[model samples]
Target: MARYWDDHTVYSQPSAEELRRKAKESASTAKKKGKNYSPIMPKSRRGEICTSWWGQAWCRNLESYADYSSRLDRGKGYVRSGTVIDLQIHDGKVLAKVQGRRRSPYNVEIRIGRLSEENCQKIIDKCSTRIESLEKLVSGEFPEELKEVFTSEGGLFPTVREISFGCSCPDWALMCKHVAAVMYGIGVRFDENPFYFFSLRGIDVDRFIGVALENRVEKMLQNAECKSDRIIDEDISSLFGVI
Candidate 1:
């Protein structure tokens, strides 16, 4: 794994092989011919936004992305917090990744202390009915103490603001524990319904696709219109001998 430095603290640790290679490179530079050569190995740069210790731990705990995703048979939830879903490279455009939990106190931790997916599934498999019942209770299907969490003044609804995101927790971070917990819970829900992930993030995948198509169409139309206008202007100027 690659590492990033932030505020005098190393967020991720390099893999064993990378560390070994770096050591060898440094040694080679030190044994040069005549001129003195600095023995420091150059660092190879990678992409921004990396998986933190917490995030990677969650994945390892969950078995793997494929297995975890398989549990979500399209009804419960999904991981929709980050802007980038997976690392994809395209032709010329390099879109900055929008997701991946960086190890920083400044951000919310959605899956910090959760059990690995494989282990959690074992528990659920052992007690499916009980787990389902708990889900319904917390969801407020019937009146109970859990209703407070989803009520307007209680939990589900929150105050909106233009300047600030309007989080009430005292963490002084971009997102509070509440936000992190919500995100983490959504990941668990994803084990039931993967489509629920986008819904939780307030994103309509279909609408996003439509918007992208419209943007491309508009760009093409603008290019065509400009070309036609230029041709017409040149023809008129030629006819009037004003070129």
Candidate 2:
């Protein structure tokens, strides 16, 4: 006879042994806090959007710039004309700034509440991964059924980054107008349906968020174990001092 009823929730939860194994695996390969992830940002028109002095020097070189641009354009989600100004999240508020026009310098500011960490991470991860996966499929040796969707031409990246907006400044620097336009457009999609990015990639954001939450829980368990070990070590040291 069973000692307790295993309802759906209880039965679905991972076994204690499984949970411990997952925590150990995850902690061993956990991402370091300050590791550079190379999160994609829009390239400035002069091709000067690099983060380091070496990158700027490379951008200044025509041969290097051409090669980098070609590779980036081939990659999914490479935008050209507009740049991401800021991404901010605070107590129940999310804010983003995008630049638009040359003459007027159109900018968009978005404020949204009730945005959870899981939801935010899901959006960032899904949108980025979907674009990258499609790009990889296009470049990969394997045959693909949806080759048209990942074509180097008519993709989201160049359109988002390079298209000239209402800003007719004549200066080549990626300024406010283009960024503002992209921001406004993406914001509307987000407002109409929060999972718009996932929809674009043929995924359910809710399901994705659930998986991320499980990963976070595993990380927390590992952290707790480390903390417990430290406490035990301190206690033993104090006892030895008294002896």
Candidate 3:
């Protein structure tokens, strides 16, 4: 039941509920056709699109560098209305189904280039001494110095060239409203789980944390037997895997 359109097709947008119904029908059709049709709906229809430093930074990155800023207004409304019926994040790619005026949700795929080894190493080296814990990192509570490293040019954030997207909405513009909604939805996901950004960039969080802690850990272990050192709680030790 998905709809396809050419340049000549003009659409009178449908009600949000109608669009949602269409998306459900399409998912049903896909399931009948033996395709995976699981859809991830937005957690809320009436909250900020993004919150926290990392999430805001993601939205800003897309607006500041990408030409999609103009169409972002259209998408903000869609995303806030819960028109983004599904979104899936993966290493180097984001897949989504954005409900539109068409007969079904439009398919959206965004390709994000993996952060290069050199850039990743640079961030690790710059932040190794400053980051206090993995929890802080994932919660966007890291120090300002670390934030600078992440948002800096050629740093953790992606540039325009490192991103490419396509949507099945058939709009001739450079980026359609459906694509914009998905982009905002991506930011919302970051607010929910910041690690999604790392996964989207193909970065391993455990490896990054371990490498960053290597020198400090070695020093701590070396000094332990030479002098008296207080032991941490069992749960804390187990949580950090230091036991």
Candidate 4:
């Protein structure tokens, strides 16, 4: 038997050994049960939980609030130890399974509210003019102006009030360590698919690209008056940098 974090059954305080043991046992049990996992990999050489622009921002947002700061610290260790087994993102929902001392993995579900109409429109309008295409946005390389659009009040990321989560763990705390691990796991998932952010917020990313396409059409129409009806080779060279 191994000591585990916040295990009330054991009087001994938890240690790094406990987390490692928990991780090993959890992984083995999960595999035996044929459960697919989307584990958060260990921190990078820089010791950052998440490396990409979107991923880092998600962690920063989690740490910014006093309520979640302390709770999230333990969750960070859980993620590093690979106790969070599987994480799935759906429209306005994130589902996860975190293994602990028990034979079964704890289920965690987090619901993020949809962005307000105003906020969605704000991102759409701002992103349209700034982001050249969906590829650049999903690649996590975009203009700095988009940052403000995403992080501002009532922006893309959900606020405290807009988030609600629950875990099947025995812990009495409102946000049990198991649930917190899943929360942090969401950030890790972002590194794999940036589009999940929009999906989690229940926003249509196509709108962002649609706005850009519409703008391009408007510009081409304006240019048509001064130039030819069809896009010429010179225009292609200027737009795509291709001859």
Best by TM-score: 4
**Runs of candidate 1 exceeding 4 Å displacement:** 1-197, 228-243
**On a 0 to 100 scale, what is the lDDT of residue 48 in model 1?**
12
Order by TM-score, highest first: 4, 3, 2, 1
Give the lDDT of residue 151 in candidate 2.
29
| Shift in Å, residue 239, candidate 3 | 44
The model with the greatest lDDT is 3
| TM-score, predicted candidate 4 vs. hidden true structure | 0.76
The positional error of residue 36 in candidate 2, measured at the CA in angstroms, is: 47
- TM-score for model 1? 0.20
On TM-score, the stronger of 2 and 3 is 3
In model 2, state the lDDT of residue 130.
42
Question: The CA-based lDDT of model 4 is what?
Answer: 0.74
lDDT of 3 by residue, 154-233 (tens): 67678878889999976878788888888888888877776676788899877877786775566567877674556654
> Which lDDT tens digits does candidate 2 get at residues 1-243?
554655334223333344334433333333354322111243333334443332332223312234234333311121232222333323222233322222122233332223334544544343233434434423422123323222223321122333233333233344333333333334332333333433333344456555545555566677777655445545676778965
lDDT of 4 by residue, 1-243 (tens): 656665657434356456557766776777888975666665652377886777888888888867877678888877777777678899999888876766567889999998877777767666655435444775555545577765788777788889999999767777878888887788888877777888898977676567655765676678678856564655666788786
Better by TM-score, candidate 4 or 2: 4
Q: Output the TM-score of candidate 3.
A: 0.74
- Candidate numbers, best lDDT first, in rank order: 3, 4, 2, 1
Q: Judge candidate 3 at residue 195 and give its lDDT.
A: 69
Candidate 1: lDDT of 60?
Answer: 37
Write model 1 residue lDDT over 1-243, tens digit each, in one string. 555734354345334344445434433443453423212111112221113322222223333324224332211111222211222112211111112222111222231122233433332232232334344433523223322322222122112221122223243445433343333333333333332322333334345334434554566677776646445544677888985
